[model samples]
Target: MELQKTILKDCFILKPNVFKDERGLFYETYNQNVFEKTTGLKVDFVQDNQSVSSKGTLRGLHFQNGEMAQAKLVRVVRGSVMDVVIDIRKNSETFGKSFSIVLDDVEHLQLFVPRGFAHGFITLSQQSIFSYKCDNYYDKASESGIIYNDATLGLDWHLPEEEFIISEKDLELPTFEEAVS
Candidate 1:
């Protein structure tokens, strides 16, 4: 696997080795040992989640609090998406900063989002199968989110605000300033 570090603290873009032939193609989606050695972080993903999003769908800027925070291994399986992450670790140098990447079926790249970061994604294709492995299980009481278009955060998701399809819950999320405060 080829791992590329992002500007955000502890985030990574992983390009797994793919072997192709006349028949089809093959790749190791996850190898615990290689992942641990390459990223130098030991994680045990207990829950695997998958979501199918249509074009223009926006989901996220979400994370769990305290011990419930999830470390995710994320990627696209069937189409494409503009995946995003925000550094919410209060004492970290990159706090309140963000990272974005285009993860698609063609390139087969995966992103590693450590605990303490908020994550979200918007589909850039007709439809996308977004999959992720989370180190922790669901925790509703600790769940929270930042508004996707928080003015202070100033993230450009490459989509017009009017064109996005967001959930009412997401619409009710706190702004960047409120979240960080």
Candidate 2:
């Protein structure tokens, strides 16, 4: 596997070395020793989660605050998605900045999203299975997020507005400025 750094601080894109034969294909998704060696950060992912969504389904721009903040290792298990993250660390130079990438099963790419960021994704295929490992357990009171269409952030979903299928809860999230305040 190879680690590629993103513009955001402490974030990375991991490209697995896939071996394909006439029979099938294989690759190591995660190895603690190799991860520690490549990224120089030893993280213990305590929870694993997966979600299945259809095309145009958008989730997130979400995160946990304070001590409940989580660092996520996210990837597409089946199909594809346009994954996005925003750095919200007040002290970091990249704070409030966003980064996006197309993650698909074919590429077998994984994104390491550090704590102090908000994350979300839009399914780009007919059906998508999104999987992730979180370093921290979830706390309802600590949950927070920014609205996906906040004018300040100016995020381009790359799909027509009418095509989006967002939950009422997510549509009611605070704006980028409100979230960090």
Candidate 3:
């Protein structure tokens, strides 16, 4: 396994060793010992979540607050996306900064988003299957999100107006300032 460090503190892109032959291919997604050793991160994922979305579908700028905060290991299974993570940790030097990566089935790359960050992705392919492992159980009361298109953050989702798709619920999320407050 290869753990590629990202600019964001404590975030990483994990590349697995893939063995391919004339017949097919094989790779190990997660191995406790290997994961802990390579990334130096000791997280015990309690829940696995998967979602399917079409091109231009923008999902979040979401996170769990306080004790319910979750660290996530995210990957794409069937297509591609421009995945983004924003450091929202109050005391961190990189707070309000963001990192973006192109994760797809072909590359089989995974992103590790530590707790205290807002995680989101916009499907770049016709459709995509996004899956993630959360270190903590999800609690609805603790769920919170920042507006995905907040001008202050200046995120480039790389989609045109007609193609962009988002939910009303996500639209109601607070702006970055409101969220930080």
Query: Evaluated with TM-score, which candidate comes out highest?
Result: 2
Order the candidates by lDDT, highest first — what do you get? 2, 1, 3
lDDT of each: 0.93, 0.95, 0.93
Model 1 C-alpha lDDT per residue in residues 48-148, reported as the tens digit of each score: 99999999899998999998999999999999999999999999999999999999999999999999999999998999999999999989999999999
Q: How much lDDT does candidate 2 score?
A: 0.95
TM-score for all models, in order of appearance: 0.98, 0.98, 0.98
- Which regions of candidate 1 deviate over 4 angstroms? none
Model 3 lDDT tens row, 40-121: 7789999999999999999998999999999999999989999999999989989999999999999999999999999999
TM-score result, candidate 3: 0.98
For candidate 2, write residues 36-57 as lDDT tens digits. Answer: 9988999999999999999999
Per-candidate RMSD vs. true structure? 0.8, 0.7, 0.8
